[model samples]
Target chain A: MQMTDLPPAFVLFAAAALLAFVRGKARWVIALAAPVLTLADAWAIIDIGASTVVPFMGYQINPVHVHAATPVFATIFCIMLGGGMLFALNQKRQVELPAAFVYAGGALGVCFSGDLISMFIFWEIMTLGSTVVIFSGRQEGSERSGLRYFGLHAVGGVLLLIGIVIVINQRMYAGEVDPLAFRHFHEMVSGWTSLSWESLGMWLVLIGMLINAGAPPFSAWIGDSYPEGSESGSVFLSAFTTKTAIFTLMVGFAGTELLIYLGLWMALYGIVYAILENDMRRILAYSIVNQVGFMMVGIGIGTELAIDGASAHAFAHIIYKALLLMSAGSVLYATGKRKCTELGGLYRTMPVTMWCGIIGALAISSFPLTSGFTTKSMIVAAVSEQGAVMADLGQSHNHLIVAWFLLEAASAGVFLHAGIKFPWFVFFQKDSGLRPPEVPWNMRTAMIIFAAFCVLLGVFPGPLYEILPYKGVAAKFGATVYSFEHVMQMLGLLLFSGLSFFVLLPMLKRTETISLDFDWIWRKGVPRFWNEVAMPILQTLNRAQKAIFDFFPGAGSESRLPPELARRIGTNWAVSVPVLTITMMLLLYLVVYFVVPMLT
Target chain B: MSDPIRKYLNLNDPKLIKWYWIVGLIVLGIIMAVDLAVHHHAHFAKDGIDIDTTPEFYPLYGFAASFFLVIVAKTLSIALKRKDSYYADD
Candidate 1:
């Protein structure tokens, strides 16, 4: 069949969900096969130019305009889905394979969706799939985290739905019928001279995309719950949700100046928290926010070069980050340990896992000859260029420059904490005396493939660069003055930073504790303080009000009973009735006095 | 010995696993030097031409920096390695 004649990805999504409803190993096989087939279908139709607009069940489903940028994202999501399934195969009892498949398939649907309505449908499906994944953890805190994760994502989905409705309404009012086409959707929504429906529509879309990107204040849900997922489930949780938001941002809100600062804040926040964290998976989870922060900054810059950088970084990050999580998952699987203090000298037995983890760490740190170096530099370089050209932008440009530097510094810090610190403590430090066998070959192979890609992209970036959206606009993959300087600076920074780590080595050792972050507000402080202190105070005040009401007996002729009985019965009536009467009488008296004086 | 010198170069104690420190530093230093001399100038450009940073200086700087770092880390590790349960149980 021609590529244009292909079926919608959502059909495959439904198939996966149906397969998940089945029992046993057969379900697992179906779950695994679904993503592989979906990936193949995506790859085949990625270059198809024709728009296939099918109206199904009162909604328009259009597979149109498969661009270079979108496919890169879709391709990575496919790869992540497949790898995550393989990693979770042994742990499939925690969550049925079909659920994971459906969840991953929903992400794939988001990738191929060509218009706003289709995007919103797939967006909610992605949220539901992820919440289920979190729920499957069945841990002490998983339910609450899952609920918060659901609540925040639902808010994002509602805003996206509102934005889509406004856009559709405006198009209908203008007598435009084609559902597949939106020529400059942002411009269309923003072109209104007044703060009308269109402007509201634009802001709604922007806010929706921002929430998905895990922008601050709303960003706490991710760090709160993601690490609480079942070991392998967290692997699936890591790949899609925020990156899909980033993908949407790339589609809808690129070049919006506000995102640059928002992205910068996320980058720094992740670094600060990750540095203080002792939980292995939560550390990795924060690093996800940090990596996505780079992509956000790139999107905010909105140049062809910057967008390509964002796209490439997302692709690289998903693989390496998943590999990192899988490594942690394997350790968690073997030792029943997720905190760093409970883990050490694992490399003695789990050498393969440790080395794979190191590769992931190196990639995340943007070390030269890893995927991160090739992709992250594009965004940094774009910011530097912006700084040089737009001098009059003044504080904005300075802020961008500072953000870029903070991002770089955070990269070094990530290397210190997650990269070197993680593997060094978990795998190579003083022995924990637990000699768990190496992970299964399938898990190892999955990790090795991702690690190999991290190195491959680092060494030979040409293939990846050629497929980027801004392929023609950015510097080609060759020797340049900036590239040379970048290499020197990277090497120097790594060396100096490594030296500093050694110098500070005495203080860098693991501790038997968890560091506080945003989650602490909900996890320990507010709930405890409110339950122990605030609730009792309110209860006491309520009782005091009741006591006052019991003591008072007011004027109505129902004083026929004994005074004690009257006080007891009338207390209930007296408090509310007298208060209401006194309030009304005071109002009436004031009105009469003022009006009478004025009339005289 | 003075504390600063002892911290940087106390490779005398056999119980300290000082050999591990020495071997790690030597291997890292050699690798850094070789990488500097041979691959220092390798780079990529937009026109697809491979070029060196300055034909002479960048690699030397990289090698020296890398060597110094590896040695320092190795030395520090030797100084810092305590009983296996130093922080584990505490």
Candidate 2:
């Protein structure tokens, strides 16, 4: 069979299934090699033209379609999996490896998905895989956080599924030939002002993707759950979810105006919350939202150059973000501590981790020779480029103007909050007198590989630009990325931001406090409402019902029921009684369905 | 545990801390000067005032924005900040 016949995702999924039955070093071989095999298969199929579509369940589903953005995202995803698995080599959590495979598998599945139905399936699969990964943490309260994460994603998945169904049905009614095609929603977005079924469907689809992208109101999930994972698990957790959402957003909702506002909010929101955070992983998690904001802004611009900027940034982001998390994970793995308050003075002993961490930090900050400098510059340039074109056309593009200023401000904020904060506090701040040994060889190797990529990509971004959706646009932008004017501009902004950090050092002192977020409403507010208001009312109603029921069957007869039945009904009567009542109602419905309708 | 990296980067050493800031400030000054040598392009010139085209615009803006974000976060912590154990019972 042709390589196209076997979707690359299936390779990882099958490996995940196999990992469950394997033991010892054998499991490592399979887990580590799974990504390599899948990448090889992915490249083979991508090299062949177009998509290989097959009829599945009465509809055409091209499960192995490679879009322009697909190659870059898929490449990083495989690289991330390989690096993450390497970091995970020594962890004893047996279930984590398989779960990670499942998660990465689903992420890969979406990269090749050619239809809405297939995309939704892979989306849900990713949710399941990631939820299991969180649960695999098995630490205090991990179960609850995993459940909440799963519940929120399930809600998003339902919204997406409902949207897909609506769009499909509407398209069928309109006699559209390709009703279930998963393509850009430029048409639907342009007509959004006119209320119609298709527009509503598209809006639902956008919201669904945004939720996964860590947009506001639901942005708390990233910080809340990611830190809950085992050290390696968090590294694995960091890579796939939001980046996948970004891929879909770049694909489906590119150029949509609303994304610009939502993206800017996340950018500032991430910096603010990260500045206030104590947990190392949580800080990185918030910054993920912040960084994704850049990509979203690029996608919102929707020009060929802008989309390429977003795609190339996604590629760079995955590597450096993973590198950042890997180093953080190394610290967490070594000290068994994730709090910045407890972590310090590690530059001495863990030199490998320290330097790797520094490299990651600089890269993340878009330091001159780091991967972030080359890649993130493109997104900023795309904005300016788009702004220039819009001005030439003399269109009303005030939003573009505001977006550029805020994004620039936010870029400096990124360095201040994450770039400096992460490495300084973890490595050089006041000596906590905790000298944890360097991480294992495998983990160190993983960090170095990614660290090297960060600098290499920054120095020479041609390899990355060549794979962007618009090749010429990205290639041209890459040529100017390292120009003396641009590099000097970036350095001036970032270094001054660094100077501000030292200036505000006293004000930036770590406090062992969590900056409460929107999740507090659901995690605390909703539960408190249920306990204080809703539960009390229900309990009152229950007491009254019990008083009436106490008088039923003469009370004596109720007490004289069969011992087994009475025992079951007595202690748990509140729950069992409703269950029995519901069962009787179902029996009545069944009787009516068979007998009453026939008699009528 | 004769670790050499500690001796090299140890900020705890007052002398090193002194040199650290000195070098850091010098680099910042040099970069700010270099900004004058290069022509700054305005990203959104037509709609907005040309604040970006000025020499040292990036440096001043970066410092101001970074400082502002921290002050704002600290202010927000007054209301949103909770004890680390706030969610412990969860």
Candidate lDDT scores, in order, read 0.70, 0.87
lDDT of 2 by residue, A481-575 (tens): 77888888888889899899999999888989898999989889998999999999999988886776665554444444576776876653644
Q: In model 1, which runs have C-alpha deviations exceeding 4 angstroms?
A: A1-8, A11-15, A21-29, A56-68, A92-96, A166-198, A391-396, A474-484, A519-600, B1-90
Q: Write the per-residue lDDT of candidate 1 for residues A167-213, one digit (tens) a residue.
A: 77777778887643433455632342355655677678778878877
Query: Chain B TM-score of all predictions, in order?
Result: 0.34, 0.88
* Model number with the top DockQ: 2
Pick by TM-score: which candidate is best?
2
User: What TM-score would you give candidate 2 relative to the actual structure?
Assistant: 0.93
True contacts kept of each: 0.01, 0.87
RMSD to the true structure for each prediction, in A, is: 9.0, 4.1
Clashes of 2: 1
Q: What is the DockQ of each candidate?
A: 0.06, 0.74
